[model samples]
Target: MDATESTPILLREDLPGGIARLTLNAPGSLNALSDAMLAALAAEFGRLAGAPETRVVILRGAGRAFCAGHDLREMQAARAAPDGGRAAFADLFARCAAVMQAIPALPQPVIAEVHGIATAAGCQLVASCDMALAAGDARFGVNGVNIGLFCSTPMVALTRVVPRKAAFEMLTTGSFIDADRAAGLGLINRAVAPGRLEAETLALARQVADKLSGAVRIGKRLFYDQAQMGLAAAYDHAGAAMVENMLWRDTDEGICAFLEKRAPDWPR
Candidate 1:
């Protein structure tokens, strides 16, 4: 086993079939993001991003809740620190969002394997992922509004995942959306039975992994790049990307295989 398998932090990992399974390990804290947890998570993700053995990443939490968002105690403590000079709270939240964004920006596909409750920033993490899968019984939402705190940070990612009105409904109501409803809203990609969460999530991740790694990476990169462009420019951007994709060795092999009526052998 790798050393991470024995660590107690916000995330742990197991390398299997080129898939990096990152577990949100702080069950007692509901996988809350403490300074340590955040640092550990960033470090682990960084490692996986550069690791040749990593082709895909699966994110899930231990126990019930995926993540309870930030550890309030740590938040309060940071506010009390000497560096708490000004906007310390804001600064911390900014850092958190930055790290969260990095996960999806990585070349490999990221799948959020969610179960139980995912609330506040925890729900934000789910929305930020490339794809999300939740157990049919899973519940998700940004509940910060319930405590008089706006889920402003989460809104950045959540807005992109669901309709404006739908996102705002959860924000205003601080109510949970069921997994199936989440999928309908585009917040989750799939919803399986609670008992089948793990197997189902892994199955999806493997489906992605089984495809051409290079192609998936290029597609993922172009997806984010194209998403930010204006509609008219997006088509142009896609065309340019398509040209680049066609120039790749795998693309040529893929087309050749199709024409020849045989399965294509992909390169690593």
Candidate 2:
């Protein structure tokens, strides 16, 4: 099926080697995360969680800007509702947060292929991913504070990936950092020329996809699980995961292949 044609708010393409690219499809609004857009993304992530064929996911935007954040017009319209938009705003943020959390929960790794500007909730989306690769000209910020709406939701993911002081500074100042600066702050893995952004992101995705899927799944789960634990507990959990991984047939084959000086014949 043509995934891109199947959805008006989001585009999906299954590339070679089990890499799935999901592009935010609203280019005219700079790919703002409208309510429909968030719903589409959440649904796609739900499907991919069970899709065994999908080994990695690449998230990109369709327009000049990666994402400019929430649809202000939509949000403003909600204010006319009887409850003064409180319930609507609550639901919107809750759904958006679930979608962000879903990225790391998926079995496959997710890479944010970012270019142009990624601000507010857009920046939150980038931080939610397992990895991010941005074009050299890209910019990132969680600048909701500038408009009187502090980026509380984005802060959850941003502070986890970036240092406390740096994250605090960005949150308070509503200032943007260039791609290179984002990389330095651990928000992205690397920044490359705009022309090479897709190629570089694909290469990185392919590298992860080349690994044994079961092992990768286990590792990905453990990586996040251990992060929230104490050092001793983290080690204990990771040790068990390592033991389980070593028991897999693929692990044995890989070890034997290494000793024999040949590539492992992994199952396709």
Which number leads on lDDT? 2
Please give, for residues 1-268, the per-residue lDDT of candidate 2 as tens digits. Answer: 2124455789899999999999998888889999889989999999999998999999999878889999999999999999999999999999999999999999999999999999999999999999999999999999999999999999999999999999999999999999999999999999999999999999999999998988898889999999999999999999998898889889999999999999999975
Query: lDDT per model, in order?
Result: 0.85, 0.93
Give residue 10's error in model 1 in angstroms. Answer: 4.3
Residue pairs whose backbone atoms clash in candidate 1: none
Off by over 4 Å in 2: 1-7
Task: Give one digit per residue, the lDDT tens place, for model 1 in 127-212.
Answer: 98999999899899898889888999988899998999999999999998899899999999989988998898888878888788
Question: What TM-score would each prediction reach against the true structure?
Answer: 0.92, 0.97
Q: lDDT for model 2, on a 0 to 1 scale?
A: 0.93
- Superposition error at 150 for model 2 (Å): 1.0
